[model samples]
Target: MSWQQIQPFLVALAIGLLLGLERERSHTAGKLPAGSRSFALLSLLGAVAASVGQWTVVAGLVAVGALAAIAYLRTSEDDSGTTTEIAVLVAYLLGALAYTRPAAAAALAVVVAALLVSKTRIHRFAREIVSDIELADAIKFFVVALVILPLLPDRGLGPYGVLNPAKVWLLVVLLTGIGWIGYIGVRALGPERGLLVTGLAGGFVSATATTASMGRLSRTVASPRAPLAGALVANLATFMQLLIVIGLIDGDVLRRLWPPVVLGAILLVGTAAFVYRRAIRGPREDLTTEERPDIEPTTASRPFALRPALLLAAVLIVALLVGRWGTDVLGPNGAVLAAFAAGLADAHAGAIGAATLASQGGITVNTALTAIAAALGSNLLVKCVLAFTAGGRRFGLGFLAGMALPAVAFTLAMVMTMTMR
Candidate 1:
């Protein structure tokens, strides 16, 4: 029992004494159960025993285990439940006696003790909110973002110059990411704010889909003013989508087109606002108590499905090949027609093909612009038809009017610009 050998024991005891003192004060205030002196003595005895049992670490562990069991029995008799005091006693012994890996063991003990102490507050928070399904959905979204997107290949393949696995998957990732974010926002905000926010967010995900959903909701929901506001918001999302797509493909092109698109959207929003205001002000009898349409949260059927990615890639390759083949066979007219056909199912590939060709100097800017417009125009027509068919007459008509008017105005402006140039 040299003085130098005893120093480590005393140091361990001091550390235990400090922790026990804090616990004792907490107990005095009814926040804990054990006192400082008892803990300090236990720590000192454990450290000395550990120093003496240096040849057999198991002996020190046995001593600590016996002390912990006695403490647990005493605390159990007093409270009939609760593990805090017993845990503190065990921690004190381990901190004092666990010298082989003292620092790591002590750090872990502190963390475990803190967590045990926080159990009451943690239980209260767990009981307050957060359903099982919401938690599951959050985990599901994380799996999609972290697990799925990175696994796919990024190259082009097949007959038409069609398949780029990475690009197609990228589109899926973008749409899924946007939809998941909107779903979370809606869940947090509730339906009243959800409708407006969802419409704007959904537009970023898919404006055509948003427009269709809004139209259907309007038909069923009797609140003319709310639906009208929602519809206007959804349509505004369409212009935003246009800007987004343009920016994704070519920031320079989007920058160039910004002024006209912004001006048109502002005018459309003003008109829609005016119409809604006038309609609401006219008569109380016209307003009815229709149930709010149950707008389901958009879930990815399976965003990273291999088949869909392959199909998209196939379409793109075919579109590129057909676009090039057509341009050679029938010139600009052939390419525009090819773009229109491709646009019916998917507009992105056609637009990308045209843009690529233009960049290569194989196609003139005017021709590329015309093909892009035709592809978009064709896609818009398909959406309008689907909206009408799926949503019924009134929905169909309103959507048609809403979508067609701006589309025609934009097309005319583009046409005039092309002619002037």
Candidate 2:
């Protein structure tokens, strides 16, 4: 037989085997449904039926359902779990899918098998780990991203074609998604894993928030080592996020910025590591992940930052408008000024504004690059102030020391990238 002709059957067989293995392992105590051989045969029957005709496929499914129903009825009512029954139906469908779309069928079969395999973990996560509020938040996220995003007019609206509902809300969704992931990470790991994990995750969502939280922790905690270290680490996200902005807003900007941004991140990581080591002076502090201070960076049960996300969305939209208007009115410096102002509130907005403007020919690429740097510098300025005011002098000094080398490295890299251009 030709490879094309044989491929679907092979895929169907593989699907049956995968699901059967999981079900067989899970059926430790039940007078259960079909096992490996039975599932395999069922899948083969489905493939054969599909190959024959539509009527054959329908008849096969009906017959299989009847047999499955009979098997369920014969088993005691006390042992009435429908997972296997549902899986049986899915297996039949996957087999049919395999006939026309073998690759898709194989992928879906793996997903089905994984679901069956992770039954316990999924149950635990839904019931024990997830709270009602988090579940609601997840639904809200889905509605916002899936439902509303599609409905929003993609074309620019409002002043100077700056306000595009879909695009602006997309920015909000991206920010919230990042925060939600960080939320899950911190909650799953808990406060036991030291502030390093917390810092990095939180920073990815909002470096300013992370820096402020770490700063507050520094003042209250016995040893400010973890807090100080965490604050320094949070800035790593700022540098990394530059790349995310450039990549998303403009490819040309990404091509120019990636090297410097990547090297800067590495430099920051190395610098943060040095500080983390120095700060962990005793066992009570952040000496180890398992045995560390009782400081918790993750707040209780919040899935994502709603207000800040909205605020950042506003800032980003304004930045875009400002970049356009400022350039039109006052030239390149206007874009730079707008970027710096926006960066003080949120650097992502600034970088995005600059790259977006450059892509649109509203400003020269060189101006965009300068604006991005200004944004970063201004954002750093705000962070420095936050560290000093919120974390106290020692934490502020420590954070600065940790950042100094990395900042120098980042500046040099940025200069080289520009000069090479």
Candidate 3:
């Protein structure tokens, strides 16, 4: 056969060989049904059948399925899984697919190999790392996002002309999803990975919440540095969530707001890194016997909370209406006040409100940008208060040091917006 005609067979052979190698390696003692040679021959058979005619391909697939069934029946009752049998059929299909879509077939082959290789890790993760509560939460999350979300109406409806059930629920899902991921990261990876992972994940769920948790930990722990480090990382998630909210609601506002938000975020991250280093590594503070027990850092609980996410969605609607009213009665400046108020509860809500206003032409992009900044400023202030009250003087002071530079950056960005306009 010409080289062109033989190309599909070659591709199929390679795909089978790659998957077979992984499957073979996975078997430590009991031999698997298919090895490299067996898989390669199956692939070649499939390719030859497909090259002949449609009927030939169907007949070939049926023959392979029959063989797989026979193989399954022959295996001892103790060997319950159908993985090898399934693999054989998939390999055949992939071989046929290689004739038409070589690139796609190759990618599928790689994915299949990876899955086979990850069997041990996946089993270990399910058995040891994930808890029953976590599994149930995962199912709940999927049901909300995949099942309930699709059933909700996408268009705005209901009282006050300010509610879109689908949009609101989607946001709730988004927030919950982000928080859930963070929770998983903290749970599976543990605190050994430190603040970088914990902080970011917690921040995604709720930066302010993370800040409060960290601050409270700092008050009790002898070395407040680790908790403080995590609090700093959480700010990163806060900024990211803000950007995400803006982008989803109004891309134009997002573009306008990104400059200041990004700048402030960078400054906050830098400050956090500096504080974390000093807190964790700096010279020893002589802790008395009584104080020593208080100094050890404690673990922060999982971050995601569904009820709070629903409350945030409620707050977003309130902010939108309040912002619209402010624009209608008091003009653009009033919208800034509304944003500040909304931001005290959740900055993302205020941001979404401002972006909605901009999208409707009630305010300019500059006004929306300013409103978002005001909201962020208000949120930061709240976090600061939480730090002082919950963490006491020492923890609060340390947090202040980390937050100052970012606060300045945000102020400058807001001022710049006014000047540029």
lDDT of 2: 0.80
Model 1 ranges with Cα > 4 A deviation: 1-164, 223-232, 275-317, 347-349, 360-362, 416-421
Return the top candidate by TM-score: 2
1-421 per-residue lDDT for model 3 (tens digits): 7987778889999988987777677765554677877888887787878888779889999999999888778763647688888899889888988887778989999988888788888888899989887788888889889999999988867544556788878877887888888777766775556656767777877888878877876655557776777777787788888787678878877766788778988998888777766765652432111234444232234444567767888898888888878888898998899999999999888878888778767788888888988888899889889888878877788788888888788779867855774
Summarize candidate 1's per-residue lDDT along 1-421 as a digit string, tens digits: 7966666566556656666765654443333445566666666666666666764445755765676566667666455544555555565566555444466556655665566556666665456434566556557656655687687676645544444556555654554465456545544554544355556665554555666666665555444444444455665755655565556655544544565567667766765666466556755322322223344533222222445445545666666778777888899887788889888876665665665555545567677778877877887787777667656777666656665566777677666655654
lDDT of 2 by residue, 288-364 (tens): 34443454555323776467767888898889999999999999999999999999999888988888788878888
Put the candidates in lDDT order, highest first: 2, 3, 1
Candidates 2 and 3 compared: the better one by lDDT is 2
Arrange candidates, best TM-score first: 2, 3, 1
> Which candidate number maximizes lDDT?
2
* Candidate 3's TM-score: 0.87
Pairs that clash in candidate 1: 160-317, 160-318, 161-317, 162-313, 162-316, 162-317
Model 3 lDDT vs. the true structure? 0.78
Q: Is candidate 1 or candidate 2 better by TM-score?
A: 2
Off by over 4 Å in 3: 1-11, 41-61, 75-79, 99-101, 158-162, 283-304, 417-421
